[model samples]
Target: MIQGAGTVILWSATIERQADRPLAEVWDNLDAVWRRFNDHEWLSGKAHGHAHRVDGYARHTALTVNEQGWHPHFHTLLVVSRNMPREQAVRLAADIAARWVDAAEHVGVVASTEGQRIGLPAVALPTDSPHQARRQAHREAVARVQYASHQAWGHPGSIAGTPEGVFRAAAAGDADALDLWHEIEEATHSHRLRSVGGIFRTPAAPRR
Candidate 1:
């Protein structure tokens, strides 16, 4: 994420789960998408979960829900041990999107259109500062917070439910909001918000 961190490569790509696969549907059946992704070896990884040794080829992947017009696509950020070729990166993103489409079809939901189009993959992007990557992360966090805050969205439980207003307050130098964010962030936490895999994920870690 810094100017130079040869040990890690940060990149991002957004792919939709197909129009037919609505967030509501995925929300209702979390397994429909998450489970299959977990089982599939779309990426070359010998390990799963985050407990793997840091030296292993670990990737931290987060799922984002875009409450857009008709389709609610997912945004993913991948931090891999090696810098993947742009072509392969695009393919990986495309393949994941296809997998989601297949998951929907498996559930008897057919999309009218093809799977989501793969956006150009950003490779070796800087994330430590005010780069696009950082902005994207903020947007994802904000969206996750918004989606979870409104229970009407039907999210099972919010892992990112810490009031975003508190974040803003904290940024404004409000010590109370900063303290509250830390308290709620720990208390409201549940499951892992992101998926970790690839050789970077050590096999020694407990299986999910």
Candidate 2:
């Protein structure tokens, strides 16, 4: 398991879904923002100097259909230095949120800062657990927060935002839901549902 400060900083936002826009087009827009933020803004040191504070990060994507149309968003978990102060972490979160909004605009999606959420790390992993147990606890922590991961339904806030709910709606003969399911499947056919970068990325194997 990757090491961290035992805290997870979450950053998420969605593009405004339009009724007339194809889901593939909308997905491409959001995907572009994600790529730009990760490449040019966050890791590239183009905007802020907080990139060094990040120890590692993971990203998960999910899609849902609503009255507004297709709602797709990214759930990014950033693990910062263990010694980072709360105030610094808060500033880092705010910076990331701002960059997210900027990234959206560059992609022609006018996203609001209010829609971007900066979830602070509220829980700390136990310090006394064995190595294996500690790894399990870390997985549980991530699974609990990223409900889209489909690892666990530990939170009971909303189901319509999950893939399971999309399928349920399709089963119920909801046309919008069916369309969303099909479109998302085609849009993300060769894409990864979850990704890791920074220090979380495994180093390339050496040639023999």
Candidate 3:
């Protein structure tokens, strides 16, 4: 997870109907897409500039390929820096979508996390029949919050321009917020304070 006040973009695509192609071929295509993203000059420049000014923003992305026995697709999650204007975010997302669509006609890409409503899974309390029920309950509570964060934010990363929302969501048991805070803290490991538990432990202060 990447921690910052930015947006996350998700790009996904289903495999084509070329049933005769080997699995390696599919992977190769996906790899090419990944390489293309890495090679994008705009991405590199924005990432470098953001990192230089923001103290902790940099390149944080996850690429994965899922294979459901003949039903294959790829998912990429990208986290950008904070304070970026929504227009710029939309433009960047559009550019990436255009690139992917150009490469694969069947690819389906969308940008979310802004004004979109998402449902979270039901909260599950830890088992009560164990001697370590208290600890288990704490862990379960954390997990519930994390899951909600992922669903609402599109990734387990920090959100920009929505600090209050992020804090509220996390306080409401969004586990991804904790994960994002942890990632941010880990990235700034040189700092004396290692834990972000205090930063997010309570609900965000009311906006002025």
C-alpha RMSD (angstroms) for model 1 = 12.9
Total backbone collisions, model 2: 0
Candidate 1 wrongly placed segments (more than 4 Å):
1-26, 45-74, 109-195, 198-208
lDDT of each: 0.41, 0.67, 0.39
- Residue 50 in candidate 2 has what lDDT? 51
Top-lDDT structure, candidate number: 2
Per-residue lDDT tens digits for candidate 2, residues 100-157, read: 7888888888677788776764556443577556555555666655653333223447
lDDT of 3 by residue, 86-205 (tens): 566556656555655454533332222221222222334333345355334433455454565467556734433133444555677879655444433343343221111211123468
How close to the true structure is residue 12 of candidate 2, measured as C-alpha lDDT? Answer: 69
lDDT winner between candidates 1 and 2: 2
Candidate 2: the clashing residue pairs are: none
Q: Which residue pairs in candidate 3 have backbone atoms (N, alpha carbon, C) closer than 3 angstroms, thus clashing?
A: 5-82, 5-160, 6-160, 145-173, 145-174, 145-175, 146-174, 146-175, 146-176
Q: What would you estimate as the lDDT of candidate 3?
A: 0.39
Q: How close is candidate 3 to the true structure, as a TM-score?
A: 0.37
Residues 93-121, model 1: lDDT tens digits: 56656766666556554432244433332
Q: Say which prediction, candidate 1 or candidate 2, comes out ahead on TM-score.
A: 2
